[model samples]
Target: MRNVSINQLDDTPRKVVALGTDYSHGHLLPFHTHRRAQLLYGATGVMQVRTSDGNWVVPPQRAVWIPPGVAHEVLMLGVSTRSLYIEPGAVDLGQRCQVISVSPLMRHLLMEAVAAPLMYDRVGRDGALFDLLLHELTRSEVLPLHIPMPAEGKLLSLCQTFLNKPNAHQSPQYWAEQIHISLRTFNRLFRQQTGLSFRQWRQQACVVLALARLAEGEAVTRIALDFGYESPAAFSTMFRRVLGQAPSVWLEAAK
Candidate 1:
């Protein structure tokens, strides 16, 4: 396979590469990881990034950060898109493991930043813009599209289903029994496979459910109860922790 040339750098230290492509239809990027952090965005249409921790759906305003060495893959959605791939080490703005929004200004700057010649020196306008872009990117909001997984493939699938049915009161051990495994076995398999405790995996499920419910126009209070939260305030507290904003505020902003 040909490595897509991102960018080229020369002189006075490390280099950064930015590569992009306009692709259409059902494009699938196989599972892989790299030394450079990847900031993937869609100028148009929707995209999804699948990492071991979860599946993050990319809205038009959002982008996914695949930190260095995280094995993952891409699934394209909607129409063709201009996928801007920033080279690693060029910018340390994006954090690991989150799907942040691409601000209007940041998006515009990145459109230009990616095109900046690799060999451009640090003193150039491109370098200055690149650095600024990094700062804005870090300040951007992370869209809610991540779905954490359990280690067992079945467990992971069940997690997705749980998100779709957050109101289900049945315990995972109940599921284990259905899957013909003891409760202990089910929990052990999930921990080994998903690299997270069962409780952590469930937390991810709750977040996904919250996002989906929000996307579907469900009220937070109802969603909280539906997700088995003790109260709306508790649910809102959890949401703020995971998404860095309260539900009422974020939902209004979403509008």
Candidate 2:
């Protein structure tokens, strides 16, 4: 099923349909919906997934779980993907979209699953492989790679603007003034709407955004300064805090 579109085999009558596809750098998959839940794995490069509710960044060797009927758009940055389109009732990863860390065994299973037939045997080796893959999926760790969007009118607009040009130094007071609210009210509202404090949300957004640039080969120093960090060391500190590894180490592992 390499390089095949899921639309052509969505009704295969199987519990899961696997497809492997390669995308050129900067390729965009316009907004689309699937009848089955999707486990979209990026074997290389990075992926940016966006829906009405939020944006998720999937780095190399990781995957994003998309529930059925969720309209989403994907920006593929040099990604080679292994996708599992599962019957909604067959697995329950979750309702919301999330980036998950793919274990080595799960990665191997994905590679083999994509190579199996579209209608693989139900009681054969391929079937067993697919079964284990689903089990591994349930055990996969959920990463903190989601940037939820706010729904309030003023707050949404402000957040959108900030995403376009994220500045780490942007203070909560600045957003409060822009929305004509006091700092206290703004902080409370931001947490209520996005489920994250202003500082936490800002840092997460910057880290997620920086991941794409870093994957595209942008120098860390430049990205750090551009994002308003005082130094590359300072930027790496924050990146490690959120992601559990330094940028260079993370990049190496991703490679």
Q: Tens-digit lDDT track for model 2 on 41-99?
A: 99998999999888998989999999999999999999999999999899898789999
Error of 2 at 180 (Å): 0.4
What lDDT is reached at residue 156 by model 1? Answer: 67
lDDT of each: 0.65, 0.93
| Model 1 Cα lDDT, one tens digit per residue, 14-51 | 34445556655467878987666767766655566777
Model 2 lDDT, residue 231, Cα: 98
lDDT of 2 at 192: 93
